[model samples]
Target: MPKGKKKTESRGAGLEEYLEGTVFLDLWRDKMFLGQEFLTWLYLTSEKNNHFFELPGGDGVEAFFENRLTLSHGRGNNRRSVAITTTEEPRDPDWDEAYTAIGNNKRVIKGTLRVKAENREWRLTLPHDTLSPQGVKLSAVKDPAETDDLGKAGKFLDKIALTAELVSIVDELFSLFLSRRLSETWLTEDVPRLKEYLSSRT
Candidate 1:
């Protein structure tokens, strides 16, 4: 087998395990509703501020939902993918439409994300199943002209490292969400507030 093919297959296998295994599906279980709450709350939170939030030991970043969202009701009802942006018209998609759907017991299953950290930016589509980032478009952190071959290799490695750090930031955000979700805070605070946020939407 070619070295590149082997590496590709190995990565594919790992992603498969991550997606289909008990770990991710356990979170996806209908009753838990962890994914839905996390996303809905995130959308609400970002709207109230400049979307500025910090990960532990990291400078703050501005992050927001990037149009695409998937919402589902248990079964029999067809799943929906929505583009929640102002520019996509004729469709005229807005929160009120989504709010109505989810109110009928639908839940958000996926969303694309945009994050700006300092001068660097990243765009990723996230499936709630594993919180693994997909279609990750990352900004270059180093100027190519400043580097020789070995230095270029090191800069490439640095980009990979930065990519991992950026994606892991989502996982940390998930952890923060999960902590709040599992607590009574979700019911006592977030749920009521989520209802208000939904109602207030256009």
Candidate 2:
């Protein structure tokens, strides 16, 4: 027998046994909770800290929940979901409906966000499960069609740079969240304060 085939068989020997339980389902559910916890923390920090953040690299950013926010709880057939939306130019941070849902133990799972760095801004919807930006809108770039053929390349590069910058900002923020979330201070200090903040709102 080929060496690779032998190794594959060795690795697969106990696969059937390991696949025969609820372990994988439990692990997946745990991961989903991490996403919910991260978004919940992000919302709490955004409100308490006035939507201002200092990145690990010393740059400042302002990110706020805007227009739409979705929160969810439970799993399978027991799952509950809520969406909060507004037409106000600057959404009221003290929106009662959002606070009521949070007070009821819902966690933010999807949200529309506005993030600003320097003078540039990005608007996007972020889903907790994938943590991927959706419907992204970046600061206006020069219209490629209006530019000379030579300048069109430059405009294209400009768009790419803006996209990259947005990704970098979001990645940094998520990294910051994970680091804090995994720390003991999260349960001891952060969560207690988070509860207090939520209570005051609702």
Candidate 3:
């Protein structure tokens, strides 16, 4: 093989093993709800020279949920949106150095990974966010008015339901990311496991 091809194959093999290991699967199993949590970890480590929660303030996880009834009645956007932000403070100065080097070089990274739900189907999303010098923001956008509600009460109830779901998913995903075991192959293998875990709780 050519030198470049040989290097590529070697790295690919190592990543493959990394994916199959228990460490990866366990992490996937934990953060099954917040879909992009694992990607956040990988991005920070590789590009930012940081560990999960490595920033001075550590990681911050936030979820936002809106309900239509509250908005329609209260006079506002009448739409619901959920957003989560996770921030990591670097404990080691070395991490800061690495991040500075990568950012200055402006490297582009691309890959695919799968996240499995409790229903035996994998949920896949483009696991990327626009990176700013400050931190990362994860957002889910959906129109709240699209929900079928007969009246104000119904709309209120719907909002509550949506918020509850968002909270639950955020909690699970945040916990998983903090544990630091998420890897590409493990997420692919644990779709069914995650589904089972979520189903049991619900």
Which model is ahead, 1 or 2, in terms of lDDT? 2
Clashes of 2: 0
Model 2 sits at a Cα RMSD from the real structure of: 9.1
Candidate order by TM-score, decreasing, is 2, 1, 3
Could you give candidate 3's per-residue lDDT for residues 90-194 as a string of tens digits? 223233332332233322121222222222112122332311111112222435556443488876675555444433343344345555445565556444443
Q: Cα deviation of 93 in candidate 1 (Å)?
A: 11
- Candidate with more favorable, higher lDDT: 2 or 3: 2
Q: Weakest 10 consecutive residues, lDDT, candidate 1? A: 1-10
How does residue 157 of candidate 2 score in lDDT?
86
The prediction achieving the highest lDDT against the true structure is 2
TM-score between model 2 and native: 0.79
What tens digits encode model 2's per-residue C-alpha lDDT throughout 38-99?
77788888888999987777778998889899999888799899999999988787878888
Which stretches of model 1 miss by more than 4 angstroms?
Answer: 1-32, 56-59, 76-96, 147-152
